[model samples]
Target: MLKKITLVVATTLLVTACGSNSETAGSGSADSGQSDKVYKLKLAATWGPTLTPFIDASQNMAKMAEEMSNGRLKIQVDPSNKHKSPLGILDLVKSGQYDMGHTATYYYKGKDLATIPFTAMPFGMTSTEQQGWMYYGGGLELMQKVFKPHNIVAFPGGNTGMQMGGWFKKEINTVDDFKGLKMRIPGFAGEVIAETGAVPTTIPGGELYTALDRGTIDALEWVGPSMDIKMGFHKIAPYYYTGWHEPGAELHYLVNDKAYDKLPADLQQILKTAMRVSADDMSVRTQHMNAEFLAQMKTEAPNVQIKTMPPAVLNELKAINDRLVGDMVNESPMMKEIIESQQAYQTKARNWGKLADYQYIKDNQ
Candidate 1:
């Protein structure tokens, strides 16, 4: 009777142990399955790996996205060297070869004329004004409408507050100085410059220094001191003109709509948040760097003379710019809508800005 009782107890203990092990195994497998799924994305940047602030925006955005998503979202950034399509980033992402792209919207003016104003127009809003307009003044909606046809969702990537007009090999004193001159400028500004009898060409950023150095191009309008200092433009071009073309040049991040849609809702929010935060980061970073570098240029590069176009010359360019914009507005109702929206916002914002910022600066200085 004692032996039979012990056997029964042993059988019960084994069954309970087996059941516990099975449950543990099942739970572990379930948790592993949920955590193991990762979405990998590819981004093509118009900038090379070393381009500061510009490249920094995309890299910072990727880092933020991965951390916020807790490793579930991974973005691999490919610079112009790897992608070999500096100017073709919009097409690369739109066709799905790349999940996203980092570039300036104005670069694709030939593709769609309506895309120009999303970036800085000639004598357009300042950086703060543009940001306000984009986030609050319906500029973002217009941008989406322009990009929708290409299956792209665009976001502001970064902004260079006020770009310098350009670096010139010779001092431009009169309107005739631009005659027969070849310049590397882009967007509506390029068209405006063209009206002055100057030839305007858009060269890839990586090739700009070489183009200017080899005399392939006579002058080029890169961003201000922050980037130009690194490119060593001041070493070659003695004349650095003040900005009028791109008052607040903004770059854009272009995402493939399908790829963006595939993201889980939470991850979608994370992606956009990352882009916004990183873009704002770049703007501040650029301002800091520009201030530091501009001071350095003044002290170290004495030969690099800062210049502004004569009033007559500027008036001519302005007239030409206004006429070209009118022509484009007539060509596309969409263009008319965009210009009207921007102009409307600019008028309202500029009024406040003149008092809030412009007057403050005038009084302080």
Candidate 2:
């Protein structure tokens, strides 16, 4: 009886050891999976909450990033004014102070003039054309070259399709009226405005409303009807103008090179995909909002006058813009490359525009 009892106890002990080993192996595999995972990122943007589409897109990007990573990667976005000036956002991202940022490429002209092609030039391609160039015409690769030295990876984020010409306290009936007008303009456009006998000032968006209200600025140009309506420009400045000069204005999302490189290959792809989605969503939202806002403005602000800039004014501005581009190309080889690429793409795209976009607008009008 004693021998049988001892044998049973030994068998039970052996089974327990084997079970323990199996559980250990399973735990090790689970740990290996956990070790491969990473966590959240931080993104920044210069625009405020009032820019609903941008804010919404950014939030969507964060959500998508988290989902794509299976909760391993997360992105936290903050307003630029909360941390740094809008113009300083790109630099902050490049330095790894922020994981990512959204801002205007033109705002960084002092860094590289090639950025102008990525944003807007006087008489540049419309929003759709610019997107085609960026996605297919090698514009994205060239932009990468420009930003590589700065240690940032840039992606097209949002666009304000054709902005207003500007708000004028008085009608700009002719080229002479453009002379001596103090307009709040930024980037290369400011230089072009200066050539037209206007003094261009760079002011933060938050402060622009007050400047215009107080007559500190004689004229001001912001994004489009949607943004203009949100800013309540019609209340202060009764004259609203069309965006002939800036046919399409593009915005960008810049990511820190090191931070981006650290991400897994799948995560990197996720970021790119998120940006493209955001870009398309933003464009659609802006178009719809502008149509609605324009209708609302017409009813709400009946006294607000909407007028187009004179053809003579546009012609002169175009000439000035050409000179500006030439001077910029002379300043840097990168600018030269960008200009060549842009012109090549423009030539190709303009043919389509002439036959389709331009003709449609002309016929419809």
Candidate 3:
């Protein structure tokens, strides 16, 4: 009987050990199946929350990144204070103070002239055409190469579409009106404006309203009708000008290269997809908002006059832009590569636009 008892006790112990091992294996598998990994990133923007279309578009990107990674990645976007200044945001992201930031490329011209290409040039491609160049015309690769040394990866986030010429205190009837005009313009445009004898100052977006209100600046150019209406510029500056010079002003999102590479492969893909969606959303929203705002302005601000740049002024500005671009290309090898590639793309794209867009607008108008 004792021997039988011993055998039964040994069998029970063996069964318990087997069960524990099985449980351990199951637990291990469960832990492994939880999810891939988690990466928390902070995205900053210089534009305020009131810029609904832009904010909404970026929020969509955050949502996409989360869903694409199955909740393994979370991008937390901070509210922008225009006080931080758009140009300052890029350096902050590059230094790892922020994981990402959104701002205009032209704002960073002091750092690298190549940044101008990333933004819009005078009489450059429209929103759709610019996107085509960036995505498929090797512009993306060139931009990546330029920003790599700065430890940042830049993506085209948004476009303001074709901006209004600007608000003026007085009518811009002749090229002489540009002389001594204190205007808030940045990047390459500022350079060209300087040639026309305008004092170009890089001012923060938020401060523009107050500046114009107090006559601190003679005139200013923000985005188009949607943004101008929001800022209530029509009250201060009565003359609203068309935005032929900017054409399509592009905005960029700068990501820390190290931080970006640390993300899982799936997460990287999610980010790329989100950025593309945000770019498209920004364009669509801007187009819709501007159209609505234009109608609203007509009814509400009858005193606000819409005018195009004088033919002589436009032609002179175009010539100055050409000189500025040529000078930049001569200064840097990278700039040369970018300008050449963009010019080639623009040449090809312009042909199509002339055939399609130009014909349509001409026929309809």
Q: Which candidate leads in lDDT?
A: 1
The sequence of per-residue lDDT tens digits that candidate 2 reaches over residues 96-202 is: 88889888888877776777778887778888888888877887788888888888888888888988888888888777887888898777888888887888887
Better of 1 and 2 by lDDT: 1
Who wins the TM-score comparison? 1
Per-residue CA lDDT of candidate 1, range 183-257, in tens?
A: 999999999989889999999888988989999989999999999988988878999999999999889999888
What lDDT score goes with residue 135 in model 1? 77
Clashing pairs in 1: none
In order, the Cα lDDT scores of the candidates are 0.86, 0.77, 0.79
Q: When superposed on Cα atoms, how far off is each prediction in RMSD?
A: 14.5, 14.3, 14.7
Where in model 2 is the C-alpha error above 4 Å?
1-36
Residue pair clashes in candidate 2: 163-243, 165-242
RMSD of 3: 14.7
Candidates in descending TM-score order: 1, 3, 2
Worst lDDT 10-window in candidate 2: 21-30
Q: What C-alpha lDDT does candidate 2 achieve relative to the native structure?
A: 0.77
Model 3, stretches more than 4 Å misplaced?
Answer: 1-36, 82-85
Ranking by lDDT: 1, 3, 2
Tell me the spans in candidate 1 whose CA falls farther than 4 Å from its real position: 1-36
